[model samples]
Structure formats: structure tokens, C-alpha cells
Target: MGDLLTFKAGKVRYDETTKRATPLAGKGLVTVAHHEEDATFVSLVWERRGPGAVDSHDGSEETEREELLLFPGDAQWVHCKKCTTGRVFALKFKSSGDRLLFWLQEDNGQAEPGTLSAADNEISAVLNSLLNVLEENDGNDIVMEDKTGENTAALEDTLSTTNTGISIPILSITDALPISSFVAHIRSLPEQALKPYYDLMPETFEHTRENLIKVIQTPQFFSSVDTLSSVFRDSAGIGSLVASQLGYPYQGEGIEGFLNGARESGLRESENDRVAKDQEDVMEE
Candidate 1:
């Protein structure tokens, strides 16, 4: 485990029932919730020491000018509004660099000294929020991709194949059909398939297969689950990977959940092998 970074952000009051906090949010701040009850929170409050210009986020120059706020303070407690969870503590940093490197410990609730990893989520969320704030301040805006039409078309194709009176489920074919054959099957699919290839082109299979091979070739392929998890933790095109196999309509949350399951399975396998080896050694004695 690496060093766990800690920051102190004063005190906080969390309502066990309402699951929300006060003061901090009203002060032009945004809060992100963690799943664990005792998971530490991290925040990077910024204050500009000099002059800077806020511009339109549309990849253009010139808009507005203002001082930049960089750091806020230490860690503080916050809660989720949707659940009756316990109060969550947060750490604060001054610079974006510090916040990026600030790792948090994720508690599994029943275990002590919880899981520790570099605060990847905290950094991504905070930086994105800050950029959004700057964009708003400069009268710029966030861009949202509209793939609804494409997604719907893709979904229809998958359902037509799956919800049919077939001898086998479509998911079963996913394993038996070779990548080329599967793609060709979809391509020859009638309009009922609704152009599923557009959402994800047929060429995606080649790339995904190559990457999977890379993962298998890694020296730590049979190492700890943590090591293997790290390999696919931020998979280059994880969204595409899921959409290709799951038949379009891919969500990042879904991919992450699947990855977590795979990690747990790997860890259990490793432990079982270790125990078996120990028993074999004892028998030899």
C-alpha cells in the first residue's frame, strides 16, 4: 500500500436520516459522494494569486477575466442526499497537482484499514468541476454528446435477436461465434438490426482482441488481483469494449461493476491455489 494522504478541513454535521450537509455547498462548492461510509473526502479549493482570463469553453480564445482560486483547505465531512449514510470526511488541497496525487482509502465496511489507491476519482471529478465553473463564469458551456438515436437503433437490433423464439439465447452465440462470424452475422442482419454497427463499427473486434492479448501477455497476469485490476482499471476503450460485446448501450458504471466482479473472482482463485499448495507441502512432510 502506498502512503495515504490526509488533509484537515475543519468540522461538519451530517444528518443520519437526510444524509446531507450544510455551509460548504452553499459557498459555491460542489460535493461528490463516495460509496463507503467511512471513505475520506478530498477537495481542491483554488484562489488566483494573479490575473487570468476566463474564456469560452468552445475551444476559442477571449471571453472574460478573473482571478483563479486554486486551493481551499483541509479535509471535511459531507454526506449523500439520497441515503441515510454516515457523515463522510474530506481532505482539501491547494493546488491541482497536490489533489491529483492525494489518494484515499476505500473502506469495505467490515474490514479494517480498508482498500487504498491513488485518489483517481477525486482528481477527475474535482478538475472537471473546476473547469466547468470556469466555463460558466466566462459564459461558456459544457458540451453533451447526443447518441440517443444511435443507441436506440443499436438496442433494437440486439433485442430482435435475443427476444426471439430461438433455440439458444443470443448471449450464448457471443461465445460460440468467432469475432468475424459474429460481425458478419450482424452485417447481414435485416433492417431489424437497425444498424448496430454504426454505434460500434465491426473493426472494433480486432482492437479489443489485440488489447485482451496484451493483458494476457503482461508478466503479472497471474499476480495479485490488485495488479491485474490495475491493468484494466482505466482501459483505453472500455466503453467500446462493453458496447461491442454487450450489444450496444454501454455505460461506464456497468463496465466498472463487471471489472470489480472479475477482480474478486481472480483474488479468490489465487487464494484457493495458495491454500492447495500449502496442503500439498504438509502432505510431503
Candidate 2:
């Protein structure tokens, strides 16, 4: 136990039924003295300065009185469970921080209810300090008790999976095409690659091209392009539309000839070079 800590009480009252001291009327001083053996028992004393003299008498002539509001080992130290009709006295020492009922009575009849409270920050600090000392002397580690009553085993299972890195994997759009390969392909395309399409729809192509350039300059554009390319590759109707727009027959012998021409072009070598460069850059990174 440490030295007694005192605080100025802003209000004091008295519970008629419980017959316990309460703060009401005007402010007063409160002091708390700790018990050496019993951690729960504490002594509380209150001192109230009387009103100043109104006559020619000096204000210093007014008498101040001290009251032993609570004593060591008082029954008020233990909360009453059944009482419901008296002033409620409470003190919280844990993170719960809720007021714990310290005094109560079965009934108050017609007696007006009363309350006592000290709002000074120093008072709260002293209370907390007292709790800390008691916990230390009792050789107990203070822990935050879980009040939610959740399943502990389920929580532990979730935490275990997180710690072991066994969570589900997330796939992004770039998984469809390597970003580096997509960037290289765009860079290799001729500036007039869309000329045929533009010739077919001049105004529409102009707007589309402008929008495409803006989108391609952004860092995430490669991933979006990869997703769109995947969709086009998987859709036969889209491929036919592309062939027809480029002035090549969409099917039959013309399709075979167009395929043959594409294979014979030097595109394969350029693609291989791009792949190799992408791999080299990845390794350097």
C-alpha cells in the first residue's frame, strides 16, 4: 500500500436507506487510505468547509468539519446484489471502466435519492494508481478479460492459419498475360496499325484511338489489356469480325492463306526477342 491520496469532491449526498455517505450540496475534500492486509478494504474520509459568515465576522471564523465517510473493512466494500432502491456508489479498477455498485438498499420509501461524485482527473489517476499497487503486491498480472464470450477455439484456428500463411490465393487480371510481354507487343506495333479500321470508320476510330492511348499510358492498363486480350482469344466471333474488318475472308481457303502469311512473317523472331528481354529484366529485378 502507498500513501493516502486525496481529491476535491465536487458534489456530496447521502442515501437514506443505505445510510452511506454521499456527495451533495457543495464541493469538499476526499481522502482514501489503503489497508495493509486486505486488498479490498479501504478508508474514506471527507472534509467539507462550511459556508462563509455573512455578518461582520471574518470568513475564517467559519468552522470546517471532517467526516469518516467510510472505514476499513466496511461492509460497503462488498457490493449488494439484491438491493435496488438506494444511491448507487461505484468505482471501476479495470479496463471495463464501468461503475461497480458499492452500496445499495432494498427500499428508500419516500426519501429523495442522493448521489456523490468526484470528477477531478487527479481523483481518477489516484484510483488507478491504487489498483495498480494492489495488483502488484498481490503478485498477479493484470489482463484484459474478454467479455464478448466468443469461441476461443475458433479464434485460435483462424489465427493459426494466418500465422502459417495458408490463406486463399487471389488472382489478378495480369495473370492472363505477363505485363512485360503485353507492353513489348504494344511498343512493337506500327503507329498506323489501326489504319485499316480507321479507313472503315474514320470518326469512330479516331475517338477510339485517342481513348486507347490515354488508357495504355497508365500503369494498370497492361493488366486491363491482358484481360481483354484473353476474352478476344477465347471468342471465335470476335476473331471473325477482326478478319472481316481487315479485308481478309473470315473462313475457308482465305483463312488458311491469311494464317500462312502471318506464320511466314518475321513476327515469331520479334516475339521471341521480347520474351527473352522480359525474362532478363525479371531476373535483374
Highest-lDDT candidate = 2
Model 2 misplacement above 4 A: 1-3, 14-23, 34-41, 50-119, 131-285
lDDT of 2 at 77: 20
lDDT of 1 by residue, 1-285 (tens): 221222212122222233322211111122333212123322233222234332222333221221112221322221211111212223322111111111122333433222222453354345444333221111011111111111111111111223366664222212233233333454464654434334342332233332332222222322333332443445666645755575534444333544444455557777999999999999999
Question: Each model's number of backbone clashes?
Answer: 22, 6
Q: Considering every candidate listed, which one attains the maximal TM-score?
A: 2
lDDT at position 266, candidate 2: 42
lDDT of all the models against the reference? 0.30, 0.37
lDDT of 2 by residue, 60-170 (tens): 221244322222211222111122222333442221111222222223343433322233223444554544432112111111112111211111111012237665422
Q: Show pairs that collide, candidate 2.
A: 11-23, 12-23, 12-24, 13-22, 13-23, 13-24
Displacement of the residue 146 alpha carbon in candidate 2, Å = 36
